[model samples]
Structures are given as C-alpha cells and as structure tokens.
Target: MTHWRKRYHFLVQITAFSLVLYSCDVTKPYANKQTVPDHLYGDAAADANANMAVLSWKEIFKDPLLQDLIAEGIENNLDLKTAAANLKAAEANFVQSKQAFLPSLSGNASAGAYHPSDAQASNTQVYQLYALSSWQADIWGKLRSTKRSMYASYLASEAYQQAVKTQLVANIAVTYYQLLAYDEQLNIVQQSLEVYSKDTETMKILKNSDVVTGAAVVQSAANYYAVKSTVPDIKNNIRQAENTMSLLLGRTPGPVKRDSLFNEQVYSELSTGLPVQLLANRPDVKQAELQLRSYFEQVNVAETSFYPALTITGQAGLYGTQLKNFFSAGAFLANIVGGLTQPIFNNGLNKQKLKIAQANYEASEYNYSKVLLTAGQEVSNALYQYQMVDEKAQSRQEQIANLEKAVHFTKELLKYTSDTNYTDVLTSEQSLLSARQSAITDKLQQLQAVVNLYAALGGGWK
Candidate 1:
C-alpha cells in the first residue's frame, strides 16, 4: 500500500508539472490589447484641470421650488429607487466574491440506532459530532481577480444610481419649468382675448353709428373669435404639462402649482467649466469606465482559469446510535482531503468561455468609448443651444417691444381717422399677438436650454 501511495504521489506531481507547461501556452486574446483612451472629448488641448465640470445641484438650481422638486424625486422616483436597489445587490455580490478567498468552516452531528435480528445478535447504538473546514489556495490569483471584478461591478452600479439621480433631477426641473411656461402662455392668450373682445365691441358700436362699415365690424369680430379660440387649446396644453410634471414627480397626474414663468430667474452667464472633466464628472461616463475596469479584471480571471486550482477540504462529525451519546468523545469522527484540478478536456468549452470573455471585454471598451463620445456631444449641443436661445431671447424681446409700439400706434391712428381701415387694424393686432407669443416661447426655450446645459455638463445631483 505504501509503494502504491508513493506511485500515486509521483503521478500527481507529473500531472501538476504538465499543467504548468500547458498553462504557459494558453494566453488571453486581449492580453496584448491596448487600453481605451480615458478621455474622448478631443478638447484636451486646454489646461488639464480647466475642463473639469462642477456645479452643486443647489447652486445650479437656485429656485426653492425646483430644488424641492428635485429632492422629492430623489426620494420617491421609482427609477431612482430601482437604481439604489441594484447598487445594494451589487454590493452584496461583491461581498460574496470577497468571501471566496477565505476558508469555510462548518460543524456536523448525527445520532442513530441499529439492531440485528439473529441468534446471539445484540443491538448497538452510536452517536457522532465533529467539525469540517475547506479553503482554496488562490496561487493563480483567480479568486483575487474575481473579487476585484465584483468590486468594480459594485462601483459601476453606484455610478449608474448616480446617473439615474442626475437624470431624475433634471427631468423634474425641466418638466416643472415647462408647466410654468405653459401657464405663462395661457395667461398671455387670455389677456390677448380680452383685448380683442373689447376691440370687437368698440368696432360693433362704430358700425351701428355709421362711423365704420359692417365689413369692418365683421373683421374685428373674426379677430376676437380667433384669439378666443386659442384660450381653450392653451388651457388643454397647460393641463397636459401639469400631468407630465406630476408623473415625473412619481405621483398620479394632478394639478401642479408653480411660480410665474416670468418670475423665474435663470443664470444669464452659463460658464461651462471645461470638457476634459467629463470623464470623472459625468455619471454615465464613470459607470462605463467602471464597467470597463470590471471587464479588465474578468480578463485576468479568465486567464487564470487556464492554470490548476488547488482546493483543501476537511470534514469532521460526531455520530451515535443513541441520541444522548452524540456529545461523547468516542462518537467523534473527522476527515481531510486536498485536491488539484486542471482542465484536461471539456469539449472545447473552457477555450470557448475564454474567447467569450475576451469578446465581452472588447465590447465593454467600445461601449466606454461610445459613452464618452455621447456625453461630449450632448454637452456641446447643449452649450450651443444655450447660446442660440440666449441670442434669440434678446432678439425676441426687441421684437416684442416693436410690436407693442405698433399696436399702440395702430390703435391711436384708428381713433383719429374716420377712413382708417379696420382690416389694417386687425392685421396689426394679429402680427403683434404672434410676435408676443413668439417672445414667450423664446423665453421658455432659453430656460430649457439652461436646464439642458446643466444636465449635459453633469452639474446637477452633486
């Protein structure tokens, strides 16, 4: 028996040696692949630190109402809640992965009775109690790499949660602002309708007194009806906007109370810190980078699988035929085992798995790059939109001023001249009303552009 044991040991050593040689031939497909660039913004020519994005949510949105809504969204929004739960789940997985590197200990106990039915046979009772332990020696760094991969995944989930929070805050703010803008537009339309109705009444009196023709009265009445028709449509829009805001707040559709749109203050000078800081500041970008890092660790784990895994196991137990004898020292039993397993053949499954891991790693790298590029594009687009809206607001404000003057002058001219064509008056009124509505829309655009810019720069949810 001793000679046979020695021969078995020798064979095990030879097998281990052969596995090491085989491992030397196995290599990762992405082992030589270069890491993806950390920054995709192409704006790296500036001061390395100058492009960093920074804006606390409080500072970015100074409005108390908006800040309150954002806070509510963080607390109650279902998407954000799901994201938080996912982060917790990832953290739990990371803990389990880390535990793989430690030894596992367990205890066991058993009690039973046995009896024999024969001439001169006697009944026997036995009891047993013991403990067991096992641990894998991660000499190949497989467990360490797996734990690190899980840690990276945990961090990625956290980043994803942050990204969700950022989006939630931005969406709530934008929707709330939209509702306010609709309110302002509705008010403007109502006021325009009131003015037109009064003008229609005055034109009717003039026609009855023969100061204006029946055709003039009809034109003025048509203008009044046109302005009045817009009121119900604007009201419907306002209600829809309110419903949208309610849904974003994670509540049933209902009324949304807000401050006047004109009263809302938006920052005039939007200083977008820099482009290079997006990698660290943008939650989506950070999430992608973490996913890439996780994949990198996965590649290491895959490479380590080509090497042999050493595991040690032990089992100790106490057994007794009599239940009360389970605690007795005579009932104690124990065992210990150690093994080294190296993949010899599995129908090419291991190799295929490695290839799949390599493909996933490459895909993660591409996704990271894509995320960075998309973030940069969004920031650039938002900045340009903010600038365009800022310019448009200025131009529209001037246009509104001119239209106001035209309305006043046309009204005055109508009062002084008996031959003043009511058609001309109606034309001027409609143009002025159109210009005023455009100005209100431009104001909303300017505000929304600010919201978009802040979101793109990853400024909110800080």
Candidate 2:
C-alpha cells in the first residue's frame, strides 16, 4: 500500500508539473475583427441590382457551338484536370489533418530461439507480442486549429479548381469566336476576288479595243492576282485556326466543321451588372478570398503551437507459447497511459514559425485585395469595350450600305460612256470592298466583346 501511494504521489506531481509547463493561451484570432472591404469593387450597397449578378452561363452565351466547346474543354482541358487533381489532394490532406486528434495503434510480435552452455541451460524458444497506441489531445486546441486550417486550404483548392474551370470556359469560347471571325474574313475575301476577276476580264476587252493601254490591263491583272493571292493566305489561316481549336479540344490537329459565320447570331443586348458583385461571381476573387481565410487559419494554428498538447493512449494484446493458445483468456493483457507535452526552450523555432505565418497571412490579405481590384478593372473595361464595339458595328453597317450603292452607281455610269473613268469604277469597288471587310471586322469585334464581357462577369462556369 505504501508503494502504491508513493507511485500515485509521483504521478500527481508529474501531472502538475506538466500542466504548469505546458499551459498556453489557445485563443483564436477574432474573425469578425478582420475587416474587409464592404464592396469588392464599386459601391455594391448603393446599387441593389448588383446583387443579381449570378446569371447562368447559358443565358449569357447563346451560341450553341460555343456552349458545346466550353463543355468539351471542361471535360478534357489538361489545366482544368490538373487543378481538379490538386483539389482532391488538398481534400486528402484535410482528412489527414482531422485524424490528428484520433489515436494511432500499432502491433508487434517477435519470436527467438536461444541456446546456452550445456552445463548452464538447454535451448529454448521465447515469444513476445504487444500493442502500442498514441494520441495527441488537443487540450490547447492546437490540433483543432490545424485541422481548421487544413479545411480552409481544402476549400481554397476547390475554389482554385472552379477558377480553372472558369478560365477554360472563357478560353474555349474566345477561340470559337476567333474561328468564326476567320471564316467571315475568308468569305469576304472570296467575294472580293470574284468581283476583281470580273474587272480584269473587262479591262482585257478595253485594251483590245485600244480604249485603254496595256498598262491599264496590267494593273487590272495585278489587282486580280493580288486578290487571288489573298485566298491561299486566308485558307492557310483557316487551317491554322482549325488546328488551334483542335488542340484546345485536347485532340490532334484536324478539320473543324462549322456553319457559316454570318449565320451565327449573337445577342445584342447585355446587362452590365455592378462591379462589386465580382467578389461573389468571379472565381478568382473567391479563390483569393478563400486562400486568405486559409492563411488566417494557419496563423491560428501557428499561435496554438505554443500551447500544451494532451494525449491518451491504450493497447491490448494476447500472447502464448503455442500458436493455438494465443487467443486464451489467460494470455490476455492490457495497459493504458496518458501524457502531456510542452515545448521548452525550443531555440525560438516556434516563435519564428508564428512570425512566418503572420507574414503569410498578411500576404494573403493583400493578394485577395489585389485580385478584387483586378476583377473590377476587367469588368469596367469589358463593359466599355462592348458598348464601343456595338456602336462601331452599327456605324459600319450604314457605311457598307452607302458604299454598296456608290459601287452600283459608278458601274452604271462607266457602262454608258467615258464620262466616268474606269478609275472611278475601281475606286468605288475598292471602297465597297473595304467597307464590307470593315463591317465583317466590326461584327467579329462585337462578338469578341461579348465574349470578353461574359468572361469578366464570370458567366462561363456554372
């Protein structure tokens, strides 16, 4: 009884010593105290409509081909795939972090044959089996704080994956629009070549009649050839565009079949939601915010490291000399132990780590603000560009109509007499061709502007 009392007293003293040495403050940083901008970009609270910025991607992009391509890119784009894998890895880390509060168990078994001098003892076999367990108790909330940090990191990784999805969708849509623009340009060039070829034949007749010198005919022929030369270049461009689109689709270079670019109509009216909503709608902004939260949690974890850790462990096992008797009740044995650990004079490593974590948290805060600012700028720029392009497209349409009428009048006057020189006909033809090309370009620009706005609004990844 005296020995047991002594042992109890010793255990009590050790427990008290450990408690005093390991006692530390585990208070978490005040979340509500961390103030962020109320509005991410422009004044959101002032504009109630900004809250309705979460429009679906389908409503934003009406092009069927564009929607299809975005879907394919999401499924097959390598960057998006890698981001998804990274998210999975982060989730695994979070799971492991949560397990830190749980006990770990291990078992060991050993058997050995020993031989002694004949005069001392005979040979014998000895067998031993045991189990060990360990656990780190979160008395100071260190493990829980670390687990929360990991959870935040996991959420951040998921946000990053969404950001990747958004980017892939935007890229695929832009590429698709680019291909359509190339098609429109090719069509315009082909029509110009046909008209130029007709002019070349007419110049030949004029030269034969001595109405024009060979120089005029040569000039007309040169113009025709010039227009014809553009055809091969346009075809080359088309092939390259196709190859690029194929690569974006995660496939080998191949022909991309599509309907006429002119037939594809894009929606003209668009709603430019207020910029502040970008914080919620833009994946990159959300990702940055999530990363900031993760950093804050990490700071909490680092601060908690200065506190004490409590652990309780237990193990049970059975052992016997014969294998068949290993499960016998008499061979059963069990033991349990509890402990507390405190860091003492660790050469300032923990202090340095806490400082690093605080610095990192500050960095993340700045990054979040930077991303928010960038998102606002993009939205503003896209809105301005879209509005400007729409006006330009309207003006180009009028210009094309007037140029077409001028071309027809010039051709009619040239057929009647020499009152209007062929030069006038050529000038009008050139003007009409230029106007048509400009109109097509304006249309392409309008489409590109819409793509830009959709991307800026984070409308691609639903």
Candidate 3:
C-alpha cells in the first residue's frame, strides 16, 4: 500500500508539471508580421482605393465575345479544375484533423474450445466479449496546432484555385485580343496587295511610254510579291493563336470568334490602388502567406513533440467458461490506466524534427517575400506599358498620315518626271503599310496592358 501510494504521488506530480507547462501556452497564434514598402508601383501609381481588381471580369473585358470565352475557360479549364480538387482534398484533411481530438472506441468478441490431450480430460468452452477506448490528452496544444495548420492549408488551396481562375481569364482575354489584331493585320496586308497591283500596272504603262526603265517596272512587281508572301505566315500565326485559346478553354483546336480589334472597348478606369492591397487581391500572394501560416503552426506542433504526452486507455469485458454465466456480475471485468510518456533519448530524432520544422518555416517566409516582390513588379510593368502605348496613339496616326502622302506624291512624280523613281514609291508605300500595322499593334499592346494589370491586381476571380 505504501509503494502504491508513492506511485500515486509520482503520477500526481507529473500531471501537475504537465499542467503547469500547458498553462504557459507552448503554441502561439498566427500573426502577420510581413510589411510592404511604399512605391511598389513606382512613381506612376495612382494612390486610390478603387482598384481595377475589385471589378468583375465582365466590367473589364467589355467585349461580349471575349466575355463568353473567359466564362468558358473558368468552367472548363483543367488547371482550375485541378485546383478545386486540391481544395476538396485539403478540406478533407482538415476535417480529419478535427476528429483527432476525439477518443477512439472499438469492440470485439471471440469464442473457443479448449481440451487436454488426456482422454479423460473434459473439453471446456471459453467466451469473451470486450470494448476498448483510448484518448490522448492535448496537454501541450499539439492537436489544436495541427488543426490550425490543416485549416491554413485548406485556405491556401482555395487561394490557389482563385489564382488559377484569374490567370485563365487573363489568358482568354489576351489571346482573343491577339486574334483580333492578327485579323486586322491580315486585312491591311490584303488591301496593300490590291494597291500594289494597281501601282504595278501604272509602272508598266510608264515603262512603255519611256518615262521609266525596265528596272523600275520589275522593282514594282517584286515589291508586290514581297508583301503578298507575308500572307501565309500571318495566317499561320492566326491559326496558332486560335489553337492557344482553344487549349485555354479546354477544347479542340479551332477558329476563335472575335470582334475587330478597333471595336473592342474596356470601359473600366485603370486605377492601380495601393500596393498594400496586393496581400488581399493577389491569390498567389495570399496563398503564400497562408502557407507560411501553416508552416508556423507546424513548427508549433514540432515544439510540442519535445514535451510529455498523456494518454488514457480503458477496457470493459465479460468472460466465462460457461455461456449461461457470461452475463453474471462475477464474470464482469474492467480496467483503466493513465500513462505519461516523455522522450528521454531517440538518437536526436525529436531535435531533428524541431530543426526541420524551423527550417521549413523560415523557407516559407522567404518564398512569401519573393511572391510579394513579384506581384509588385508585375503591377509596375503593366502600368508602365499602358502609359507608353497610350501616349503613342496620336503620334502613330500622324506618322501614318505623313507616310500616306509620301507614297501618293512619289507615285505622281514617277509618272510626270525623272525626279523620283519606282524605288522611292515602293519605299514610301512599304513605310505606310508598316506604320498602319504598328498602329494596330499599339492598340493590341494597350488592350493587353489593361488585361495584365487587372490580373496583376488580383482581378477576375471575384
């Protein structure tokens, strides 16, 4: 009895010690210590609360056909689907983690006959039935930390899904605009072909009248063929762009329907808002932050492992040699035991676990920082590109006007006098065509800039 009392006192002391440690709170709650500096968008950013990312994709990509394509991509894009699946899996893991705090119970029954080898020995029947339960006390908040970690992972998965969705919307819109630009370029090239044909005929008449040499006539024809040869390459580019959009929509390669580049309009004001808003807007940024939070909890879990674990196990059963007496009070048995385990030595495994967890948490912090910087870079680049393209619009039109006049003036000079030649006409005409094409490209750049900025601001997923 004295020995038993000593053992009981020892158990009480251990329990008291563990409870004291528990009161100290070995796990810390998650906190955001990350900071974002000023001027993430450089000097060009408009300091406003109204971010374009807050708008729905429909508001940004006002084109009806482009909106339809973005909708289709959200519904069918395989990467988005995969992200959704990952979210479901993370949710399941979080649910399972919550269940870890509950006790586990199991039941079992068995029957057997036992007999001696001697002939005179009588056979005996044995029967037993039992139920067992076990539970581990979370004296160090280990289970709580694990649950929080899983919840963070689930949130990260959700952010990942949204990131995929935003990217898909941007891809669909960008590719659709590219197709439009290609169509316009093709139209411009075809128009040039007709004009070149007329100029070639004019050159032939001039050569016949002795106004120009054979060299001039051949040069005019050669210029026409050169412009015509670009047709196939442009068509091929259009086909490839269509296929790219088709892939984004998770469909077979085919032609994509789109309005003319000049007809598409984005009415949303291009306000970039504050750079600090990236934490809430950018899905990838949010995901990285959540991942860091998860790792923080994991480190807490690892720290808890170095402490003691308390578990309780209980069993209740009925046993009897005879079936009729199995239910009697005399055959009833029950027992319960509480145990405490403290790791004394394990080849430094516990220390190793803590070190590994700490390293991972630190690594996640670095990765999170990198993601923030990248987000800022994207916002800055998109805004700068839009500004540059917007500024070039008036100059581009003026340049095209000048080139057009040059082409016309050169043609008349070749017909009237020897002051200019066919080479001069060809050069001006080519310059005019190039300027027109560049104008179309400038429009494309402006459209893509808006799309990219919207995406960079974490738009479209809402």
Candidate 4:
C-alpha cells in the first residue's frame, strides 16, 4: 500500500509538470509579412476593393462557350478530383485524431485444455473471457497538435483543388482565344490571296500592252502563290488550338466553337486588388501558407515527444475451471495498471525528430514567402502588359488605316505610272499585308493581356 501511494503521488507531480510544459509551446502562430504592398501593381490602384479578383468566373468570362467550358473543367478535371480525394482522407485522419485521447475498448474469449504429468492425469478445460480497455493521457497536447495539423492539411488540399480549378479556367479561356486568333489569321491570308490574284491579272494586262515586262507579271503571280501557300499551315494551327480547347473541356480532341477574335470583348473591370489579398485569393499561396501551418503544429508535436507519456489500462472478465461454474463469484476477475514512460535517452531519436520538424517548418516559411513574391511579380507583369497592349492597339488601328491608304494609292499609281521601277507597287502590297497581320497580333495581345491579368489577380476560382 505504501509503494502504491508513493507511485500515485509521483504520478500527480508528473502531471503537474506536464501541465507546465504544455503551456510552453515551442511553435508559435504564423505572422504575416511586416510590409505587404498596398497594391499588386507597382502604381497606386484606386478603390483597391473594386478588384476583379472578387468577380466570379461567370462574370469574368462573359463568352457563353467559355463559361460552359470552364464548367466542364471544374466537373471533370482529374487533378481537382485527386485533390478532393486527398481532402477526404485528411478529414478522416483529423476525425481520428480528435478521438485519440479517448480510451479504446475490446473483448476476447479463449478456451484451453491442459494436462499435468502424473500416473493418471486427465485433461481439464479452462475458459476465459475479458473486456479490455486502455487510454493515453495527452497531458502535453500531443493529440491536439495532431488534430490541428491534420485540419490544416485538409484545408491545404482544398486550396490545392481550387488552384487546379483556377488554372483550368485560365487555360480554357487562353486556348479558346488562340483558336479564334488563328481563325482570323486564316481569313486574313485568304483575303490577301484574292487581292494578290487580282493584282496578278492587272499585271498581265500591263505586260500585254508593254506597260510592264513579263518578269513583273511572273513576280506578281509568285507573290500571290506565296500568300496562298500559308493557308494550309494556318488551318492546321487552328485545328490544333481547337483540339487543345477540347482537351481542356475533358473531351476528345475536336472542334471548339467560339466567337471571332475581333468580336470577343476583353474582361470588364480589370482591377488588381491589394497585394495582401493574394493570401486569400491565390490558391497556391494559400496552400503554401496552410502547409506552413501544418508543419508548425508538427513542431509542437515533436517538441512534446521529449516529455513523458501517461497511460492507464484495465481488464475485467469471467474465468472458471469449467463452463458450468463460470458465473460463480470466484470466477470474476479484474486487473488495472497505470504507467508513466519518460524517454531518458534513445540514441537521439526525439532530438532528431525535433530537428527535422523545425527544418520543415522553416522550409514552409521560405516557400510561403517565395509564393508571395511570385504572385506580386506576375501581377506586375500582367498590369504592364495590359497597359502596353492597350496603348499599341490604338497605334495599330492608325497604322492599319495608313497602310490601307498606301495600298490603294500604290495600285492607282501603278495603273497609270511611267516610273522606272514597278517595285514600289509590290513593296506597298507587301507592307500592307505585314501591317494587317501585325494589327491582328496587336488585338490578340490586348485580349490575351486581360486573361493574364485576371489569372494573376487570382480571379477565376471564385
């Protein structure tokens, strides 16, 4: 009884010490950056709250076909599905962690026949049954830390799924527009071929009348064929871009119907909210932060491992020499045990775990910082691109106008000219063709910049 009492007092004192250690949490809560930029873009943004990142996918991508494609991607994308599955598993683990401190109960039954060596020994049957229970006390907050870590992991997986979703939406929009641009280019080239053929006929008439030489007519025909030769390549590129869109929609490679490139309007309200918003809006950044959170909790768990563990175990059951007397009072049996295990030394295993956990926590912090910097850089790049293309689009329109007039004037001059060289007409036509193609590229760039801005601001997931 004295020995038992002393052990009881020792356990009580140990429990008190454990309470003290629990309060001294080695891992601290994560802190935000000391100086987060006010706006993602370098310059001041008016009404930062009026950002397009708040807009939903339906609002940003106004094209009906694109909206439908985004819907299909959210529904059928394999990466999102995988992330969701991982989230489910994490949830299960978290729930299990919540129950870790609770005792476990189990039952068992056994029968045995044994004989002792003697002149006339006989076998006797012994039957036993037991209800066993055990529990571990989480005095050092180990189980709670596990629960916290698991919950963080579950949230991280959810963020990963959202990241995948945002990426898919952006991909579908970009590919659809690329296909449209290719379609427009094909039309432009075909129209140029028609003009070239007409010019070739005029050149032939001039040659017959001795106004131009046969070499001029031949040169005109060659230029017309040169423009015509580009048609097949443009058609192939358009087909491939369409196929890319089809795959994004989780369908077999095929055609994707869309509005003409000229007809598609840019996303409305290209506001790039505050840079601080990236913590919540950018799923990759959010996931990285949550990963930091999980590792932080793991540090606490590792720190707790250096302490002692308290456990209580018990077994109560019925046993007898014969089944007929199993219910007798003598057959009733019960036993209980309590234990404390302090890891004095184990080849530095606990220290190693602590080291690993601290290193991982630090790594997570670094990764989170990198994600923030990357988000800011991308937003800045998109904003600059948007401004550049927006300005160039106006210039492109003016250039297109002047080049049209040049083509018209050069054709008239060639029709009645007594100039030494007819090369000016050919040169003007070539310039016009190049300018028209560049104009198309400018418009496409303007539209593409909008898509990139939306993504950089984390616009699609919502």
In order, candidate lDDTs are 0.75, 0.72, 0.89, 0.81
Each prediction's TM-score versus the true structure:
0.85, 0.84, 0.93, 0.91
lDDT tens readout by residue for model 4, 85-193: 9889888988898888679999999999898778766878899998999877776778888888998998998888888888888888888888888888888898898
* Candidate 4, poorest ten consecutive residues by summed lDDT: 26-35
In order, what is each prediction's RMSD in angstroms?
4.8, 4.0, 3.2, 3.2
Residue 26 CA error for candidate 2 (Å)? 1.9
Better of 1 and 4 by TM-score: 4
Candidate 1 accuracy as lDDT: 0.75
Worst 10 residues of 2 by lDDT: 43-52
Q: Over the full model, what C-alpha lDDT does candidate 2 score relative to the true structure?
A: 0.72
Give the per-residue lDDT digits (tens) of candidate 1, residues 168-213.
8788888887878778777877888889888889888877877778
| Residue pairs in candidate 2 whose N, alpha carbon or C atoms collide under 3 angstroms | 137-310
lDDT of 1 at 267: 72
- Compose the digit string of candidate 3's lDDT tens values, residues 50-105: 88888899888778888889888998998999999999999999999999988899
Which wins on TM-score, candidate 1 or candidate 3? 3
Across 69-147, the per-residue lDDT of candidate 2 in tens digits comes to 7667777888888888998999999999988767798889887778889897777666668898886655666666777
